[model samples]
Target: MIPPGPKAEKLAEEARTRMLNEVDERRDPHTNATVGQLLDRYMKTLDVGRSTHGMYAKYLEKHVRPFVGRLKAGALDGETLDSLYAELRRCRIHCTDRRGVDHRTPRPDECDERCRSHVCMGLSSTTIRHIHFILRGVYEKGVRWRWVARNPVFDVDAPRAAKPDPRPPTAAEAVRIVDAAWEDPDWACSYGSR
Candidate 1:
């Protein structure tokens, strides 16, 4: 007793899709797995050096775990991943030095303190990209296991790497370097001869 029209067709489609998803979830062993659980399992199987393993653990706990740990694996999507990267780009942390001392203020002459932590502490693009890499690996595993339909990280735009400082050598400096090379007899015998 249903009227056939565009509205009815749309309703029928939605019902069919919902039922399909429900069935899929029922069959999926990881449908109930949280993001944190997935990451924990993935991390366990990952092979890395002692230092690198520590670094990965730190980043996972600080960034990804805080935001998406509780989210169901199947619920994740591209837009969700996009916002996570955007959050990482503008992330700020308390500027600190190797000794764990706060150095919030920078030297008046220096432009910025990326390597040295100060009040303007923030994660670099390289660091953000690294974090993304770890997540991508875990999500790909999820896809292969049929825990999720797709990897959301694939839909996200890549992080923008910071440009390196351009320091072209002066012509005078270049000439002095060449003059020094010619002055050395040992250099001429081994390298300059070729």
Candidate 2:
């Protein structure tokens, strides 16, 4: 019988090691699976529009991944989620705004002030409610996959979002507004004599 060459032996060994590693990873109870993994699974199951998937991926990468990427799939809990929310609020305030030209770094203290007094402080209740919804969905998937026994999000109460004041314009109001605009000389000039 011919002896196996070193190259052949190395290939065989690599194949065997890869197979074993895959099995081991699958069985590893404490293996870290980040929000990215959950997001992929969610995208597969969700019947939402592509826009929603894009939005969720953006939020997962920007807000969720940095804090929870190293945490084991089973290690997330209510307290951990709460802490993550706090961190997100803090980060939003301190986040660099490069809206205009000449990307200057705003003062660190100014950033903190903006975060605490405005950005963090003024976060709409609707935004907080949406965060709660995302967390609930993520943890629910964890439960479904047997990574978690129960959703931590189920145990917490999110603040109620303020209802938008319903202001459907009446037919008369609409007509009045339209008529006023049509009669205005400035409006006619701006709208090309329409």
Candidate 3:
């Protein structure tokens, strides 16, 4: 029964296609999976250098997992992610504003009075950007897998990249360095301009 226009026909067809896709998505268990599960699955399939892979795993474990690990992938929104980032910025360890010993020893028996009290240190913007990178990739994969229709991360703003802050040696320190270099002919030879 009919819409005579081409545009009308196209719109009707798109609606029908979307309805069918929704039905299929409803039956897929991945649609209900949590972000943590998605991250774990993504890691298993990620292909990268050993060191990069290790760093990604470490970032996920230490940052993302502790906060929103239990949240459903489809349910996440930009606000939730923003909150997570804010908390991380406040304290990397998510400290309760209480003092605790920052233990260097794995075994408490090995711990001594020398262990210093923990200080809250927020992650740098660059490190936070790395976290954003990991989540963006993961959510993109989730979209492809139909776990989510859209990546929530697209709505969030990543922290700005940090600029390098360099400090040149003081004149006194530079003089000391020159003095030491000339003390040995071999050191002087090694200090030549490239």
Candidate that would win on lDDT: 3
* lDDT tens per residue, model 1, 1-194: 33688699888888888868977775444479899988898889889898998999999998888778999987777788877766665544422233443344545444346344233346788898898888889988988877776787887766887789998779999888888887888995787668
- Per-model CA lDDT versus the true structure: 0.76, 0.66, 0.87
Clashes of 3: 0
Worst 10 residues of 1 by lDDT: 94-103
Give stretches of model 1 more than 4 Å off. Answer: 1-30, 48-52, 94-118, 164-166, 182-185
lDDT at position 120, candidate 1: 39
> 1 or 2: which has the higher lDDT?
1
Candidate 2 yields a Cα-based lDDT of 0.66
Q: After superposition, which runs of candidate 3 have C-alpha atoms over 4 Å from their true positions? A: 1-30, 169-184, 187-194
How far residue 154's Cα lies from its native spot in candidate 2, in Å, is 1.1
Tens digits of per-residue lDDT for model 2 on 1-194? 22478688777878878868966766333436755576567667877789987776676666677777667656777788777776655555435543322223554333433242223343456665676787689778776775555577776677576988999889999988878877988886887654
Per-model TM-score, in order, reads 0.66, 0.54, 0.72
Clashes of each: 2, 1, 0
Residue 179 alpha-carbon offset, candidate 2, angstroms: 4.1
Q: Which tens-of-lDDT digit does each residue in 1-194 have in candidate 3?
A: 43778688888888888878877866333467998999999999999999999999999999999888999988889999999899878888788899987787757656677788899999989899999989999999888877777888999999998888999999999999899889898878877744
Candidate 2, residue 80: lDDT: 81
